[model samples]
Structure formats: C-alpha cells, structure tokens
Target: MERNFMTTTKPFVIIGAGIAGVHAAESLRNEGYEGRIVLIDRDTQLPYDRPPLSKEYMLGESSESNIYLRSHESFNTLRIELKLGVEIVSIDAEKQIAITSDGTIIEWEKLLFTTGSRLRQLQVKGSDLEEVHYLKTLSDANNIRSKLDNVQQVVIVGAGFIGAELASSLKKLGKEVTILERMPLPLAHILGEEMGEYFLHLHQSKGVNVITGDSVVQFDGTSQVEKVLTENGRVISCQAVIVGIGVIPNTLLSDEKLDVDRGYVVNEFGETSLPNVYAAGDCAMWPYRGANIHIEHWDHAVNHGKCVAKNMINEKSAPYSAIPYFWSDQYDHRLQYFGHTKDWKSTVLRGNIEDQQFTYFYLNESDIVEAALLVNQPKNALAVRRLVKQQHPVHTDLLSNPDMSLKKVHLRANEDKVSY
Candidate 1:
C-alpha cells in the first residue's frame, strides 16, 4: 500500500538529518505529503550512515560516497528543502515554531525531532589531552582514522559495540588494545551474562586484552594520554585513549515539557506529551512491544521515525509496535539479536560453536523470549523472531535436535501444541 500523506501548502519541518530524519522525510513523500518539506541538520553535509564509519570506512573498504544516505537529486526530486549546518536552538511549542542558532525562526504545523545523539564525554584529568578521542561524528571518525598510524597501545574505556568494534579494527592494524568495561562481562546487560561470556572468549581469543569490572578514574600524562588509572588503582600505559562509554540524546532544543528519562520519553506512537511535536532516533525513548519499555536501538529509531511521520499527517494511524532488532560486526563474526531477553530464565544454543555458526535462543519458562545469531544464519533468526513474537512454546526435544530446523519446527506444529 502506498503510504502517502495529504498534500498541504504549509511545510512540515523536521529537525536533524540523520537516518531517522531522512527516513521521516522519505516517508512523508511516500505517504503522499507533497507539501513543502524542510529537513534541518546541524551537520554541514547530508545525512550519512554511521555504522560504516567504525567498520568499513575505518578499514578503507568503503569510501565517503558509500556512506551518504540520500543524494541531492533525490531530495530535490522529493521537493525537500535541505537546511544544512543550521542548528535548531529552541522550540516554541505554543507558537508551533523553532528558532535556529542564527536567530532565524521557522513556523511549522508538525515538527519531528530526530536530532540523534552525541558521544558521552569523559571528565577527568588528561581528558583534554591531544590523543584522547570519542567517536561519534564523521569528523571524529576522520580524526581517529588519521591517528591510527601513531597509536600503538590503545585504551578503550567501554566494552560496548563501538569499543568492541574499534578493538577489532585496531587489532587488524596490529595495535595492542585493552578494553576496560565496568560490567563483569562485555555486553552482559544487552546479550545476557552467558552469551556475553562467550563474546569475551571470542575477543580474548583474538588477542584483545579484555579488562572487566574496572572503570577509568583518571588519565595521567603530560601533553597526551600516556597512562590510564582505573578505579582499582591499576595504571595501564597507552599511547591513545578512545572512550566509548555511551551516548546522550540531544534534546536541549525542546522547551516543551516532555517526559525525559535517560532519553526523551515517548509513547508507542513516538508522541511526546506535547501536541504536534514528535521525536524519533537515538534521541527518542519509544516503547518496545516485547519488553513493554522504551528502548534505544537503531531499528527502533528508523521505525519510530516512519511511525511518527505517518501519524503526524494521518489521524487514523496505528501505534508503533515493532520489535527491537540490532546487529554488530566484530572481526569475522556477525552478531544479530532480536527482541528483549532481559528476563529470560534459560538459553539454548543451536549448531556447533566450533563451526562458528550458531543461534542462541533465550526462553522465559516455556515461552521463547529472544534470539541472537552469530555468523550469517538469517533464516534461524527469522524463525526464532516469529516464535518469540507469538510467544510459542518450543519443545525441548525439537530445540535440542541439531537436525530439526527452526522453520520446519515452527511451521509443522499447531498453536495448541506450541503454546505454553
């Protein structure tokens, strides 16, 4: 079905030209909203995919051209007025207008805030050093890439996706890497402790110094980052420091009182407390179906963007109820995870770990709750996602059988036999 919006004379202003904002603009056109569309971004260039920056772009496998999400011609064809390098300073909800950094005011009937996020800063001694870096923006990536030659012993402050990926990337360049994570295991909270332990092994096997249960208290150096002092009083020497702790949503422009949690709180429809103003992307904290809690994921961001745009133009739109999904590429392994399994009681691993192709399914009692696959077994992920969504009761015998495919198992059984 064509998801087009009604053509109105007044322009629909969208802030931030990230993936979410770009998708929202395209979704507006696809919904038949042929009216004036304004896409404002603080970046001097057009919106680009950030995932490639740490992986392909850093390795020189992909160029800058491959990172561009939309071309100028595409925006021109869609009649989108691109406002690059203009920062939205503040928003007046009552007036339905936004003032830019240059004091230019623009009125809008509906506003979509896709301002995304910025990298969390580290406030400590030697944080202002020349070699200390935080990767978030394209410029930051460029700077990091340039310094790769001089970086010998790299200290990563967090063991999150960015930190892990950077460790793998720098390892490929023959750099000694040490990852310091406060959690007991890397990705322990997101992928659960057991699976996180497996990942720890994977990183250590690849010669990465995985340091957990430690936090960087301070950096001791003269003009550059020379040593990192942890909370445990252990000092580690490093030529460069890359802090990948986390990110904070950029929501300072919104003057209206919206529910702000760790991020900007929004309902299932990506609607904040304010009327006519919506949010999406990393800046948004929208609800997840399975977890029934607001989550921050790339998939959630894109989905929320489309949902918010559609609801802004249409009155009879459905609420955002998509499952949260995300993936990470580290070394040669492809990690794909779907749904939330924070409360899962049991986890089953399918396929051989030695073969490097397996799917880990997390179950709560008898219900399949979540699944994560390593390597490129997308079919298994799809089948498990369906079972999780339907809350189907998976048989222990069938799940344990290496010969029995998840697709066949799911399709052959009836709901009565599959129910918990």
Candidate 2:
C-alpha cells in the first residue's frame, strides 16, 4: 500500500485514550503534525495511569488527581480534541469514517487503535457479587478503595503482578490477605520455579497467606462476597474478593475486517493490515525477535506510542526496536525486568538470593544476555538493560562475582581494559 503523503484537513482519529493513545497524540504534535487529532474513549475520566490502580492508589497513598496522565489545559494547548465517554460503534476503512454509538459519524485521514485491553473476569458462580472487583481503571481502584474499611479479610485470586501487588497493599493496610493460584508455584511460568519460589516465600514471610495448586471454583455470598470456595474443597472466609487473572485485548473495533490473532497483527512500523490504519499498546501485536508478541507493560506502551506516531507522520517508516522493560513494587522490594524471552539455556545469579537482594541473568547458548531480573538491586538495572540490548557475550565467572560491575562484564573479552 502506498503512503498517504498528502496532508489533509481531516482529523487523525485515535480510538482509545490510555497511555498509548495519549502519548501518540503528544508525539504527533511534537513531530510537527499540525493536523487535527481526535482522542476518543468510552471512559468518562481523563486518561490516568493504570499501574498505581493496584498499588499506591488502592492503598490511599496517591490521590485521584495525581493519577491523571495529562492536565485538561495541556490537551487544549496541543489542540488534541478529547471525546471522553463516547464510544465508537463502528468504522469503515474504505470510507475513512467512524460511527459513534449516539449516531455520530467522524471522518478521518488516518486512524490509530490504542484501545488497550480489558480485565479478564472470573465467570464462575457468584462472580457478579457486589464486593468482588477487578482492578484495571482508576474507577475500579476507587471502588475497591471505598470499601477497604469494611474489608478485613480479603481474598485475592491469581498471583500475577496485579494480584501480588494488591496483596502487598492490602497486607500493609492490616487486611488478612489470602492469594490463591492454580499453579503449584506463583509466577513459575514467567519467572521460573526458583524465582517463583522466592516470591512465594517473600509474600509468606510478609504475613500474606500464599496458597498454590488451588483455584476458586465459586464465590459464595448472600448479597456481597462473604467467602470463596476452591476446587480442592477449601472454603475460605473473606469479606471481599479481588480477581486479577489477566486481560484480553479490546479489538471490537476491528469488526472482522482487520487481521486479528492474539491481538491486531501489525508490522515493525505499527501499521495494521489495513491501509491508512495503525494499532499500538496492548491491543497491537508487533514483530519482536522474529515473532509477533504483544507486551502489556507500561514502558512498552509509551515507546510504542512514540514510535508509531513518527511513522504516522513521516513517509519513511522505521522499525520499533525499543527494549521491553517493566517494574513491580511489592513492599520494599522493587522487581525490575528487562528484555523478553520465554526460553533460556542457563540462569546465573548475582548477589545473595536469601538476602532478598539479587539479580538473575537469563542467558542463551552463546552466553549473551536475553533477560535479567533485578530484585531490590536498583544499581544494576541500567547496566543489565544495556547488556540485554547489546546482546554481547560475557564472562560468567565475572558476572557472578559480587565485586565485578556489570558495566565492565562485557569488556572481559580483552585482557587490558576489557572490550567496550
């Protein structure tokens, strides 16, 4: 397909106003795109940060006004039209127009889908109880926080990032928290059994009850959530319940006209299969290391928005090559992970794992760093990111040494100063 090089008066319509959509709009203005930008979302509130919804916001440490990504005046200064609480019912790629639910049609020269993802709700018995909640939006956090006073014994389902983070926050609030996971070890698939066991023990040592190899079969309550029943015939009494199993990409606007797999399939330039259209954030799966992968982290969304916005403006497209990065704060431990890899040949550990401060390096056959996990080791984060991005071989002996710095580990190939 040929690029739309001609600048038109029509608006550049963006479907969702989350991190990706907001950044895309800002990047468009910064990239000298003076055309009309329409940012739309079904949410009534201004675009807000989501990571805090389960952590600081739920703990009441962060205020509602602090969670917003941009001020109202900033949007006006950028000349970006904010269409909050409006849902785009349908769109015609052929006609280059979109129809809203309230019988409104919007014309556009280019369209970007930053629709993000929706929470994966538990569909079992009593899942619709009043006290049961899923933390995804600022409003969800508000709803959960409003009832925290009455919620003494809280049951958290799933031991993923959100669930673990919520457990940490609730435990800090003096709530008796119980986390139920179907897998034998929490986060074993993503962080491996060793690191997963560390997390299991970390939560357990912090007074949070971590139950593995069990699943919630039903939520029993009269009006609100009173207790939870597990598949192993274990009934746990709780005043409230929070479910955070996962999320599914919101690709409803695709309407079967665009290519869809795990998400909207896009190339390196963030261009969808359809012409004059693009997708980013959690809803778009772009090429990564010869595979199309969708990352649901905040860092990826910010960089993806910036990369795609440049492509939308320039006739020459560039590949999105930003390294995938994300961080989680559970109690005092800040877990930072860099790079993306599902498989590794061997894992190397630096510092003492039992001390709760360490870094784990996932290496391929060539001794090149594929990913690294830093547990409470903030000093090693930047160096680890560089090693993963450089993809250079390193000395394992030096890497495991506590005295050796990671910035110099890649230089060990030479005898004098080490290779740069």
How many clashes in each candidate? 8, 2
lDDT of 2 at 301: 93
List model 2 lDDT by residue over 1-420, tens digit each: 222222246899999999999999999999999989999999999999999988888888889889899999999999999999989888889989888887677889899999999888799999988899988888878888889988799999999999999999999999999999999999888889999999999999999998999999999989998989999999999999999899989888865569999799999999998988999999999998889888999999999998999999984476899889999999989999999888888899999998989999999998888988999999888888888887777788888998998878855633332434
Worst lDDT 10-window in candidate 1: 1-10
Cα-based lDDT at residue 418, candidate 1: 47
RMSD of 1: 4.7
Alpha-carbon lDDT, every model: 0.81, 0.90
Off by over 4 Å in 1: 1-9, 290-292, 371-376, 412-414, 417-420
Report clash pairs, candidate 1: 3-30, 3-31, 4-30, 4-31, 4-32, 5-31, 5-32, 5-33
